[model samples]
Target: MDMKKMAGDKAAEYVKDGMVVGLGTGSTAYHMVNAIGERVKNGLKIQAIPTSKATEAQARELGIPLLTIDEVDHVDLDIDGVDEIDPQFNAIKGGGGALYREKVVATLAKEVIWIMDESKLVDHIGAFHLPVEIAQYGSKQAMARMEECGWKPVLRVRDGKTFVTDNGNYIADLHLGAGFDIEDVREKLGTIVGVLEHGLFLNMCKRMIVGTSSEGVRVIENPSK
Candidate 1:
């Protein structure tokens, strides 16, 4: 089986009936949504809260029952994708511009599981440009502040226009120089104004299922667990 698909299938095994699940967005996460759809069709009962409008529409098309976060106090589990996962299990996500919503959903979940192909694993992060969601009004100020912090902040444009996220914010893709501590980086970025959210996720992933062609699959648990 394709490694990404295999990883999603394996993660789907953790989904059970009568639970609230947080659905993620991305190619890898799309596979998981399909797997959950098949289970729902087979009479499995679950309510899903999608982190992005794209994911919400896709899940509805697949007939997976959906609910908004306002309706649920907590999510039983959250399965999402990551752009880069470091050795410490800290991750950078939001390549799809869903980081703000993804973070909200993830932090609310009792457990968060990241599913990915082995290619996303890294020794240290900052390879893929980090995504930072900033309010449009003062976005220029935010980018300048980010540059002051030693990052190359580039405004993301899609189809010749500013890339607007589902939340209607602009994106600043930060090319952070490699080899920095994830927590330190997050703390530094958190101090900037107009910075609504960033892709750096720290100490939030409870489990990670990595799919490999030769190994089939590997499930790594959080060391603190």
Candidate 2:
């Protein structure tokens, strides 16, 4: 049933005309961006801010009008994908190395929606290694600090080279293991000098769209909404 596409397309339905939208990065977000592009072709009007260079290119190719973050006071909505989301709605993101920009966009949006397949939903979040973006200049020291705290930090690599994000930072995937304290870890990571942003998305999402092969698409509103 292509659950990723299902969830992504469903999230796109929330977009309306004359609004400013924050377009997210990742595989699931690809579908949402595509769906929105189709709408734009049919005369839907909205200004979009892409979370990464990859997304910006896609949005440009799709004829989606683009805006820089500095041009917008606030985004009406932001839809992105999560690597892992727990029952408490805490999520692990940045699997695509766009965590820093994604976090910034999400923070500027009035509403945020996360789209993912049912497999991403878990009883807890730590199973998926938390991604922390750090400045390249002192990345090694940052990783060393994380390792000292037992996070088991591993630098992300792609094509035999270190994976660099759109913000030109390095990503360290932290293996927190099971039953770890989310708040404590987040606090500790923030204390690191070179740490720019981490993948822990807490208390931000207003809704989540999950796609399932059996039941089709499910939209869950945040309890705090």
Best by TM-score: 2
Q: Model 1: runs farther than 4 Å from truth?
A: none
What are the per-model numbers of colliding residue pairs?
A: 0, 0
Given candidate 1, what's the lDDT at residue 62? 90
Error of 1 at 148 (Å): 1.4
**Which residue ranges in model 2 land beyond 4 Å of their true spot?**
none
Query: Clash pairs of candidate 1?
Result: none
Every candidate's lDDT: 0.92, 0.94
Clashing pairs in 2: none
Write candidate 1's Cα lDDT for 75-129 as tens digits.
9999999999987888999998999999999999999999999999998888899
lDDT of 1 at 175: 86
